[model samples]
Target: MAAGGGSASDPLFPPRAFSPQGRACLALGSPDGRVRAWDTQSGRLRHEYVPSAHLSATCTCLAWATGRPTKEGPQRKKRKSEAAESVEECDLLAIGTTVGSILLYSIVKGELQSKLTGGHDSKVNCVRWHQDNGCLYSCSEDKHIVEWGSQTCKVKCKWKGDSGGVSCLCVSPDGKMLLSAGRTIKLWDLETKEVYRQFTGHSTAVSSLMFITERPSSESQPFDGITGLYFLSGAVHDRLLSVWQVRSERKEKSAVISFTLTEAPIYVDLAVSENKEEPVKLAVVCRDGQLHIFEYILNGHCKKTITSTSIVQIATSGKDDGSVPTPIPILAVAFCSDKQSLLLVYGNTLQPVIERVSLKTSEPHICLVRDIQKNLTLKMKTPILKVKTPVVKSETKVLVPGIPGHSASVKSGSSGTPVSEGKRKPGDKEISIEEQLGAMDIDSMKAVRRGGLPQTDSFAVLLVQGLESNDKNILNKVFNTRKEKLIKNTVARLPVYSIVPLLHELTTRLQGHPFSALLMVRWLKAVFVLHASYLSTLPDLVPQLGTLYQLMENRVKSLQKLSRLHGKLYLLITQISASETRQDVTDVNQTAKLVYEEESSDEESEDEMMERDSDDNWEEEEEREEQDVSADKEINGDSDPDPGEESEEEEE
Candidate 1:
């Protein structure tokens, strides 16, 4: 795989997307611009589609968007054939091509819905679907990130940066934040359509971005205090996997935990288990046919870092029998719905294959069991039946690009085509504007303060109100929102006077709801971070801080003891289970031995009985033979006289 070069004959690692709604099927694209949806469980192709306008274009990326029901228009009727296959509830799939066009396909209709074009001038690298709003985001080599309306295929807004063209894009779960990466990574606020924060770490262009979502525990008291955002970024050129923590700041440094891989990774994905005990699993597909998996858990105590506990690497190059892996280049890897197995797509385009690999970790080595039954070959051709699509009256809106932070030009027109404008040297209009502003004097300016009541139901207002009133329910609302941005904004905008009250409310809440220790501690830390400078100046707040510290200390002590107990009990139970298993095996062996001995004893007794019967029969036969011999002696004497008399009578 390492020796191969980028040629037409070489195998292509195309992008793949699994259905988010059901996880029943996944869409895989090929270099020749063909997309195939395969059943995740059965590994059978449900439908194969080619973009209508992309006859010669190459596919670069794929994304599956769950269909959102809208009252804006009636749903289109799916064909009976497609409905029977249960694709009527299927979602939309967005496919990016090298021709700078995005093809939207309807899984229900089994056809292309619309072709979004002219947003990019170069090959599209990444396409992400925001399911919350049905909007589509795509980044391209043209150095622009374009946002397209869901119903209208027109570009809503276009963003460009000078960081050597955005190569990858990631949308936060709430659909409020967007992450674009190239030479540097930039987090964009989707609501404001502005770069919220930027991060610098990877020396080369980033190839993949995945958000690591920490699912809440299913326990009676779930860990509901995950306030920090964590994601993973990897660059093929840099050969590094970086874990980044999203912060409300201007810029940040490299990833918290930087893991250098042996081979350049082509794709990366994160799978969050529903179980709280299971760590967030990350899978990286490397160029050397090696799939590296890292399981990490976010430590709320240290919100900025994740505990990278277990790492397992398996080769995706061998046959399904877990044979010695060949050096075949792997194209892509995806976590199955079960999270315990992986769906791997390797081999060349001519004989492209998809296989499910079940992974198990032992003490020293990871075991891989390839599911031969689910190994699907993607080389088969399914005849494409063209479905007639109704004519959609498209209203193309003129794209007004925003000002560039880096050296970037705004693209305009219906197709999002780049409208080149000459660089203006502070033009006459700008000079006049500056002169008008400079001409205004202090005497002409009057400060105006507009007073209005804040929205009582807003997150910030509710938080402040809750702090003043000590309303646990209101505070729970703020916490239960689970929106990290809202929480941060509320904390940052908290009034200086209410700082003590906020602390008091947090302490009181902690006392009542001890299960929310993580949340309470995190809020306490945030308060200190924001008001550490002024907090010491006020000696009156010292008592409250002390009390809070004591509460946390007690909680920590108890938690430590419980952790030790859990560990000991787990070890003891495991040993007992092992012993019991051995005992059962021993019992089975002894039972088999006893049964064998009983059968042998029974056979020996039967043999002795047969010997006794045979001896008795021999005695009886001897007595009968002696009696017969005496009878024969008598008969012979009589027979001799008859024989001679009969012979003389016959002669006469």
Candidate 2:
């Protein structure tokens, strides 16, 4: 129901890897140098397995074994039944690590059963288990894809066909073909150990590859017999995703569909609905903070597009009852039997943020779900453990010298006055400024303090800090000031009720942080100016003002940074002025003065002359326009042109 509900849980430690059974998520971080299991639904810890032999490394990828043993003998039937029972019974996790090692863990026993090492020269990036055979496949930055036997963790085959490092690897549902995507898509015949075909449509490196399966024809038919597998590959530079169909003979591949996106996806994972009833949908996450869902139609067409913030991985969990198949006789429905989809998003920032989107609903809520059991309980216990706690640290009030303080004045040229210390008896509480800031829970404030501006002072201090930081090129002070002005103008033109809550939030949560507060104040001022200037022409101002607001809301932390604030503010003001909102003339002039002051400090005489020449060109354009207007009026008095004739001439 809410925007971030599904992401309310804690992020998976060291990220996560999804199995075919999406209900169980695997966390491969070195929590005591071991791989752990996490239940996705309940956010509970399932198990933890540590292979004592494998130390000083982190697991990077994981896959579940789905293959059956191919041994033949008199004990075949009993062995098959026993294998089926065992395979269906216990969950298996295959882990790939930075050391180019693969470890197979038994979920029921919570122990490592088998380990494979040195197959890859570099870090393994992806791992997948063959559906029909007890075999494991992995791709690494070493530019190799190595297949291993499930029991021994022995390399069955190794394919090094890519020029660049292999980024992703996938196996066909039938286990006949393996696909490795890197600079291009390379297809390998698992049975023959031959590189059959190479597809090269991507301009950039390929990040992921998936095989979409067709539906079974009847209950009696085997899954591989009924369904045909097709490949979907995602590329980075071109921002192009291509769908290819393998010929029935399995010798060649044909490109059936392709689509371009605004951003190049870094890591693309796919999920297919298990219900044979619904249209095919593909979820893609791009590097440019966008999550896209594409619905496939007949004749190789992608009909719908939905976009969101940066999504890193996507996986499906079986089927649901709501996806009824339309009877339009389109493409064959191939469902993965999984009911839901898990999307791992890196968020707008580097902080890893994962979101689970339910295909059952168009508007999905994002919650920060934690895979680790400890975090899940912590999340649940956080609100219920109602305990009144007192601040344990006393606040320190610093009094600068020459500020006319009643006491604690420092001599000239000496270090500023020391903060007054107070002693509290046992049980008396005190709080620090850091603790107070933490309680506010404002994301931008956290960023600002982390960037070295922990103390808050008056507006003058803010301005000075902004100017000083501009030297580091971290803050664009002029643009930020202009942006703040725009926000202020927009808010002023809004109804009183609309502005009150924002102002209240600024005064309360943002207390003591005068720099951030001043920025907000300036934004409100700019919004007011824009609204007033375009009050009679609201239609034209609406879109531009909306863009400005959206930019501000999205870049909250960057706006709080004093260095870049002024530059961003000035740019916003210029944009607004260009949009016919002729307001804040004096403020604009002051901002210009500040910019000149900053830029003038570093310029030769020739550079200054060039800058002056550009200004003169602008002035000359305005003067020439005035002269042309006067001349046109004099000519019109001498000879008036008929309106109809002018219209006809223009049309002609």
Alpha carbon lDDT at 334, candidate 2? 14
Tens-place lDDT per residue, model 2, 392-448, is 223333333321222332121112222233343465445556654443334554445
lDDT of 1 by residue, 1-652 (tens): 0001121112355566667764566676766667778776676678899765555676777777877543335678868885555543458888887768888888877877898987988888888888688889999888899999978899999978545878788888666788888878888878787877778887777777877665556556544222456777877566677877775542355566665566777767667666657767777667666666767665532333332243444344466788775344556667766677777666554344567777663332453433322354458788999766333223322223322212222323233322232232343223244433332322212212222233468877888888788787898888664555666677888888888888887888788755776676667777788788878877356676888888878877898899999999999999999998988874334344343345665566877899999999999999999999878978877535466888898899
On the 0 to 100 scale, the lDDT of residue 161 in model 2 is 56
Q: What TM-score would every model get versus the actual structure? A: 0.49, 0.43
Tell me the whole-model lDDT of each prediction, alpha carbons only. 0.67, 0.54
Q: Which candidate is the best by lDDT?
A: 1
